[model samples]
Target: MKAVGTSESHADAVAICLTQADYKGHLCEGLYQLKTYVDEVEYGGCDKDAVPTILKESPVCAWVDGNNGLGVIVANFSMNLAIQKAKKCGIGWVVAKRSNNYGIAGMYSLKALDAGFLGLSFSNATPLVAPSRALEGALGANPISVAAPATNEDYFLLDMSTATVAHGKVEILGRKKLPVPTEWANPVTGALTPLGGSDPSSNYKGFGLAMFVEILCGILGDSGYGPYVRRYGDVHQAANIGHCFIAVNPNYFAPGFEERLSDLMNYIRNMQPADPERPVIVPGDFERQHMSTVDHQGGICYAKDLVKICQMLADRLNVTHLSPLI
Candidate 1:
């Protein structure tokens, strides 16, 4: 656990970590495929020069066609385009297909906000959510993430999966060989409980939100939806999932947006906290805190076991080794 300072600075630390991690074979395969995508699409569009221009361009709307490449690399490039475009226009959006799993949505959203724009990102994944009372899985544990700069406090970040519980969380518990909370997942059937799946019964709303995200990313992006989405570990071929992003400059909406935002933020911070020992914190608070801890420690703590796996992968890839970015 770490406590990071203001959000913008914290984001810079995260960027360093991601870049260092990438250089160490984190997403090397995917990066190569992405470069190829740029080549193939260079001469296919608007300006005969547009394709070539895009290939050399730093920011433009693009479809990764990951070709089963690393989702994290493709996603980073795709969102970079959105942020660059947003700087020029009031808002910019991008949709992706044939992409693999990106580690976290907030990772991408924060990229834009770090550049002074409100950032939004979402992705469709393997179906692991149930709709309504039906037990069959019909949706992905899709996630939506957002980030915005703050004047007097940390950047505002909201990252959440639309499912009762993300599939990753369940997998983590399973990996530890621990019994998942009965409320967290269905024990006998091995299904995720709906959001609020635990106690007071709030899963119906979560189920609805999951469907909403599926429609936006899967349906709108022309990616298949429902149970038709394939699993990552399935023996079958890789799933060609979809993602969507939007970045906006709030100044386009009204004058002094930052000042107004700062005012509202202070009000929220002053509100009574549920626990006296813990102050009321807003979105992005915990992440900011964690980043600070890592900085002081000179890097994040990776479990010894995971470090061995990473080392093995790096050795096999023979990529340039990178030290951890704390």
Candidate 2:
């Protein structure tokens, strides 16, 4: 990140998001995408110096201009602003334009959770998903993330992309030293393309969800909508991606919200499994487990090729290379 002209603080902020994704087992959004960020900067599509300004503001609402800055920085600023407003008004909503690739949406939502409030995050990305029955992509793999606090450090979090799979998985899996899952492979040709042998109903639902987020992040945020956003591989073009953050005080809505949510999650987690081996779990359970595993392991696992790539990047930038701890 320093090699790409980002300040030390800015690079740290970006590292937090990317590392969090890797810690949570979302490999596609982690170090695999760092090269893309570097390219985005070197190609002049993203600005290293970001001066995010509030274009419009009210007690409970705000509009932010990212100044074409780093998406992680822009998202952190916007979400923190929303958290401040929600503290006073019980609810706060913020939207940002001229942002770029914010690797993971869950980080912003978790911010509100840390603040003892519920959080909702939405973002529109590059156009990489074709709508149902369409031949080409018309909408991005727009993602929605929600985080709600429960009792005793438990929580409910839903962070997912609306597309069948993020485009990164199509190529980055090989780089990550992982093989494709056979569940989605074709029985005849043994071919696997989540977007190619896609399920119509799932894509239909995904398309609708993508549009819903696009309206919040793109249309309302006044950034490019659908295909108007830059292509994922086109670093020469500015992404101008948009994002939305909503923070709410759950206590204001009803009493015992956290307690009730805790009860529901616990009961479901303990439910009997039909397979007897695979127990039912809630949305955020796997992430918590992954985080615990990462901590226990004391470091993240990276493919040797990815390590080599990072070393190559460090060499190009005249920086110290990673020590290859893994």
Q: Write the per-residue lDDT of candidate 2 for residues 152-226, one digit (tens) a residue.
A: 999999998887677667566655567656333333432332233455445466667888999999999999888
Alpha-carbon shift of residue 155 in model 2 (angstroms):
0.6
lDDT of model 2, residue 226? 88
Deviation in Å, model 2, residue 226 alpha carbon: 0.6
TM-score of 2: 0.92
Please give, for residues 27-85, the per-residue lDDT of candidate 1 as tens digits. Answer: 32112222222222232210111110122232445444444444555567678778878
Q: After superposition, how far is residue 70 of candidate 2 from its true place, in Å?
A: 0.2
Q: 76 in model 2: Cα distance from truth in Å?
A: 0.7
Off by over 4 Å in 2: 173-199
Candidate No. with top TM-score: 2
